[model samples]
Target: MSPPEHRIIAGIYHLSKDLGRHFSLTDINLQVTNGEFVFLVGPSGAGKSTLLRMMYMDDRPDSGQIVVGSFVSTRVTRRTIPGLRRKIGIVFQDFRLIEDRTVFENIALAMKVTGTPMSKIKQRATKILTHVGLYHKRHDFPKALSGGEQQRVAIARAVANRPAILLADEPTGNLDAVSTRNVLELLFKINAGGTAVLVATHDIEMVQSFGQRIIYLENGRIARDHEKIFVGDVRDRMDESRVSRRAEQLSEYDIRDEENE
Candidate 1:
């Protein structure tokens, strides 16, 4: 196993809502190692988004702590939060691109805020836009692109700084099947390049075939955390009917049984 510096560690964390009427999340403990691709899956209100937020330091845990690289939640201050965020990339379900900015500018802005040199910003932004297959539309505003294209640009912006970890929340929620596949493929490609990727989503059928580590969240707690086992090429299992059948099989496993209990 790698040392703590190479992992995202959450230590017995807890959080609640509505003045403690109910716990939004509790007893959460997990670690994401550098360059690993993992999925955080659960139904809505399962605290998936909240966990991501805490990892990035957007919100602090009510108890315990989270450590991302060298930054520790127990020691982080407002003045240092930006420094921590620069080491992590974040993507949202809704395309959060600035409507008024061109695709190139949207990506460049991310680099610019981090004080990247202008020459390098132009160079990196162009490379990322081309990598995402949207260089041709670099001058177009967000509204000018299709939904899939917009999401690709959002991904480009998210990773513009080359962060060590990328957190994506429900990245395919609004896309049609084809677009969803495309966006997920892009994420896989990025992960292959050695950036740790953690994606949160409620759509289990879309991700079960990938054979990656999956941490199942239910009622604000982790129900299961383990790598999935699949036979043959994962791509071969991606057909709709096959994935649906696999999902059915998974429901009989411990994760689903715990959910029922």
Candidate 2:
């Protein structure tokens, strides 16, 4: 028998969204697979944010079906939304870190709410901060960091739980040229770690240059899906299975310690 296809992490079928009688998204169909990095490109009001919100189930569609991990939008309830969110991570254009909390505390909040034990949470948080090149500022508050630094914190927090998919909406919007490059590089590193990444941005030049999959949204629909299609790891031809770099595997020392214990 063939292995199960858990690679397809998300799917949208004939989806539509409305904003107070204004239809924001119309008949959108899309899929994101494991270990793949995709770009969602569109101008403002192109429904990029709206589509991301629905994928994470912050809002349900008015006309179609959506699925992330195991929770189907048509079947999931408010009570189940938390569980669904646990399997996915999201970063917004605005650095939504807690203003009152230190950087460490802000990242810790996500793991804490999901019932992560203190020991592992600390280990994972430290490792992820380093991964995003912000370990030196862990003691600082969000306001103390520059805009680029703040976004790095947000990205770190999102992946702290090692979600199966990471959705970032305009993560570079508030950044300058250097900062934008830095943030995008970090995101690619995250993708290399094996978490499927979907970036929603209006940067046509960047998206085109990346040479990865690009799903262009216009008005409220997907006008184009530009990609080089492949089944799985083209490197290891024997096993075409999808691969992922989970959040827990960020630090070899921590993983080894846990195993030794």
Candidate 3:
């Protein structure tokens, strides 16, 4: 075999977006060596998404050094976004699947848009769908599937291109306990196969259960970085009570509270 690939991503002095102001990612250096599974944890509105967005070129940093594999993302042009996107897979919590399309079609669409040949599309799509444990549901549409299944289809579509890096944002937010375990197991398998994985999530319990290396952000900067710590039994981090729902709704009012003061 040829020589092994070196580090997949490296960044130092990253300064990106903030809430209507500049944020300092300066002295914020990190390195993701090949085959590493890393977690990016933080509170909501703490720039976790913004940091991840910079990696995929959805948002550019004001000034920073970023290198992904061989591509210098901070210096790349807009024309290179498609190419970069093809090389990195992203799993979104909202499951950005097409409600109108079947699971197989949704996965196939990515390859097709990238100009993948028709002959190879079906083979690759089928393989990845099976990899994400959705081969049997290939004919089902997003609306027909459970929250977990829909997220699985999203994962399938993301990894269809066999990207070098996979970025997942709150992937297990809506999933049940069993589904969460399955999804995390699947991610572990992917990481074991030499893909660099980075996950941004608020599922503290799941993160604790899995015990992976974690980088936590607070108020737009890393607050505490910790090694994977297995502290307790697996637990559900979300609450489905009406009070929680009401509290979520109260965020709007809470914002008003800040304004009133």
- Which of 2 and 3 is the better model by lDDT? 2
Off by over 4 Å in 1: 1-21, 228-261
Of candidates 2 and 1, the better by lDDT: 2
Clashes of each: 0, 2, 0
Q: Give model 2's TM-score versus the native structure.
A: 0.84
| lDDT by residue for model 3 (86-147), tens | 88899988989999999999999989979999889999988888788889999999999998
Candidate 1 residue pairs that clash: none
| Cα lDDT of model 2 by residue, 1-261, tens digit | 986455789999999887555647889999999978999999987889889999999988998999898999999998999999988989988989999999999999999999999999999998999898889999999999999899999999999889999999999887765567667778878887889999999878655655679999987889999984644433332122111121223245456878999
Compared with the true structure, all predictions reach lDDT values of 0.81, 0.84, 0.75
Clashing residue pairs, candidate 3? none
Deviation from native of the Cα of residue 92 in model 1, angstroms: 0.4
Best by lDDT: 2
lDDT per residue for candidate 1 within 106-218, as digits (tens), equals 99999988999999999998899999999999999999998989999999998999988899999988775556777887887898787888999998766776888898988
- After superposing all C-alphas onto the true structure, candidate 3 shows an RMSD in angstroms of 7.2
The candidate 2 region of ten consecutive residues with least summed lDDT is: 238-247
Per-candidate TM vs. native? 0.84, 0.84, 0.80
Cα lDDT of candidate 3 equals 0.75
Model 2 RMSD in angstroms: 11.6
